[model samples]
Target: MQILIVGGGTGGTILGNSLARRLANEIRAGKVRITLLSASDKHMYQPGLLYVAFGQMTPDQLYRDEASLLESSIDFHVDPVTEFHLDRNEVKTGSGKTYAYDLLVIATGARIVPQEVPGMAEGSENFYTEEGALRLHKRLMEFRGGTVAMVVSLPHKCPVAPIEAMFLLHDFFKARNIRDKVKLQYNYPVNHVHATANVARWAKPEFDKAGIEYETLFNVREVDPVKKIVYSEEGTECKYDLLIAIPPHRGMEMVETNNLGLGGWIPTDRFKLTMNDHDNVYVIGDATNIPVSKTGSAAHFEAEVASDNIVSVIKTGVPVREYDGRVYCFIEAGFDRATHNAFDYINLPELKPPTKSVHWFKVAYNQMYWSTVRGLL
Candidate 1:
């Protein structure tokens, strides 16, 4: 059996490594093959980009050679697929090479499109990319005092990032002894400060205590760079010294070009993690249009479930278990304190108060992420 996993990000890497380990004997006996294809040779720990923006981490620390994190038994390629021939169980790559698979996994992930919003790309700074994070860090260093506003668009990855950015900004200014001089503003599109109800309940009080001013129901309409003002669809506007935006996101262009799903998000079975109407094709991470937070933790959980089911099906002629929409995310309250939320489809997440110990754990996890991609965690 040939298993092809596309996109070497969190989901594909974990699933590939897990399958390589579990199917070692089968592979050695020439019964199973696992191949992973990715666009880049470097695998980034994406959550660390926030730290980069804060100057807590450098861009070099956020990356690892993609091959170094994978199992030796797994075949890894840096060629990105340009065309998906799902009907023939084949994919054509950028190098004009075609590969066929018995079982396919698509984890192509999402891309941030600040261009979708008018004037946003020109006016706001974002930390979603390495260059953007470095630029934001430089801007933060040059900032003396003024209002630092955070603007968010819907359906972005890591829903808690903007909230975390606000807390970090508060702490950052406080550390610089300019807390009184710098004003922090958080603007969200939704009516609540956070899309998640429990999270909003917990973070709202913290924001109030930290003196972080926020305005909800403020969907970004356009950014006036010359006037340094951001206009919302609701007719409200905010003038700022520095604008940080969590821009809109969409799944990969390849997914859209292939007509796999609307907006490049694959129609996936919420529990089984399979592409809708296609049992042999699985979708994970941001590629799936599942009602879950698009975070690495969600991808990790889904990969585990998918790999387990794949291994079970190959060995026992039947699949075992289902993804329960489990997601475990650590919320960084500030530079030195953190909390976490763990929930599944049937359960609502109950967030604990932030603690320094959890913060330390999150810090340690940054380095331990290598082992995680290797399927050791």
Candidate 2:
């Protein structure tokens, strides 16, 4: 079977690497052909942006060459995809080349739309853009210290990032010996935390210890840059010396453009990553509207299920594997401390405080990311 995958971001590249390695035998026997399509020369470690904002990690450490890692057995197209002809099972890239396939995977991850919130992308300050990151970095360094407010706009990528910002910013200013110069605040739509209580258990205590004031159920409406203020829909106004916001996250345009996924996402069966819309199409990662935290761990888990199902389909057209919707996130609270939580199980597990052990796990996860790229995972 000819398999063509699109968008070499987190979902695509990792899936391509795994699929190519697992199907090496099929490729050698001329039973399968795999290819990856990308628009850029570099692949970014998006999760690392949290560290980048605090000046903890640099831009150079976050990017890697896409072609170097995708095996030679798999064709890599470093061109932007203009359209996906789902009807014909073909993809048209920016270079005007069309490749047909028997099985297709849509791993094109979601891209955040700061502009969706009216004044957000107009450049007051945001963490969802490269320009925004540099601007926020400057805002952090130039801080003489006053009210530093970090607000999560709504549902966004790596949900823990905004909270991480709150704590890390506190640590940042503390390192400068100017911690008392400003009051730190965290504002989000969650009732002071996240959708799950496991995070809140540790987060609340940390906030208390750090002396950071937090606002939950607060929906930000606009940023008045000139006045150094944020206005909310509930008639609440927050004055800030510096504003760092988690912009709105959105799905890829391709999913809607091709009419392949749910409203704007791929609806997959809970067990297997098979598309409910079509038997031949499988979608994973944040692009799919799975009931799980849209994190790297979820993507890796989806890949495992999708790969098994694909092999089963090739054998007797039987679908195999099911998703547990298992997703976990390690929240970095700065000062060599971090914590993570796992949800979606029938039974609740007790969460240990975000501790030193969390720190070591996070350090090793960087190598895990590289290993996935090298197809070792």
Candidate 3:
């Protein structure tokens, strides 16, 4: 049997490593073959991008070679997938290579397209990518102090990152003794600041204490780069000296090109993590149209369930595991302190108040993630 896993990010890497260890006997006996396909060899620790923007972490510290993180038993392909032929159970890559598999796992993650909004690509800065983070870092250093508007374009990963960015910017300006000269504001599309209502309630006081302004239901219509104004569809406008924008997100191109689902997302069973009509294929992470936060922790949890189901199906033609749409995130609240949130589809997040120790835990988690990818944790 041959297994093809597309994507080498957190979810793909974790699933590949776990399966290699679990199917070692089958791999040795030539009964199963696992191959991982990724567009780039560099595996980025996406959670640390915010720190990179603040000059708290370097890009080198947050990335690793994708192939190095996997075991020798799995095949690694550093090529972009161009098309998905689900009916034929085959995938074509940019290099013109076609791989056929008995079982396929789609973890090809989301992409941000700033061009979706007029003038956004030219007017704003974002920290979702390494280059974007580094660019924002340089811009922040050169800033003399003015209005900084952090805007979310909706359906982006790391729901708490915009909040974290606001808090950090507040502390960053204060440290320079120019806090009064700078104004920090956050604008999001939703009616609440966070997905979990209770967490938002808890965070309101923190925003008040920090003197950061929060606006909700602010759907971005367009940006005026020359005027430094962001116009909302709801007839509101915000002017900024520096705009930090989170672009609109969508699934990989392969999903749309193949007509898998609307808006390039795969329609998966929320609990089973299986494709709508393809029982042998599974979709996880940001590629699926689930009502959960697009987060690394969500992908990590999905990986465990997907891996078990794959193994069970290969062994007994049955899948027993189900995914629970759980999401976990650590919110960095400046001043060397952090808070955490844990929730699932049916429950409100249980939040841990900000503490210095929790900040250290977020720091340690960056290292722990590397270990986890190597199957050591």
- TM-score of each predicted structure versus truth: 0.99, 0.93, 0.98
lDDT of 3 by residue, 1-377 (tens): 99999999989999999899988999999999999999999999998889999999999999899989999999999988898898999999999999999989999999998999999999999998899999999999999988999888977988888888888999998988989998888898888886568878878889999999989899898999999999998899999999999899988878888898887789999999989999878888999998888888999999989999888887888888788778888989995999998888777887768999999998999889999777777
Clashing pairs in 1: none
lDDT rank, highest first? 1, 3, 2
The alpha-carbon deviation from the true structure for residue 157 of candidate 3, after best TM-score superposition, in angstroms, is 0.7
Question: lDDT tens digits, residues 1-377, model 2?
Answer: 88887778766777787778788899999998998888787887777666667776777877788887678898888877778776778888779898888988877777776676655565356666565676788888898979988667755777677778788888899999999998997787767576567677777888889998988787888877777777776677788877777777767776777675654567876666767866677788888877666777777777777777787777768866677777777878876888876765464435677788897788678657877766686
Off by over 4 Å in 3: none
Higher-lDDT candidate of 1 and 2 = 1
Clashes of 2: 2
Colliding residue pairs in candidate 3: none
Which one is best on lDDT? 1
Error of 2 at 331 (Å): 1.3
Worst 10 contiguous positions by lDDT, candidate 1: 146-155
Candidate 1 matches the true fold with a TM-score of 0.99
Among the numbered candidates, top TM-score falls to: 1
lDDT of 1 by residue, 178-197 (tens): 89999999999998989888
Can you give the lDDT of residue 220 in candidate 2? Answer: 80
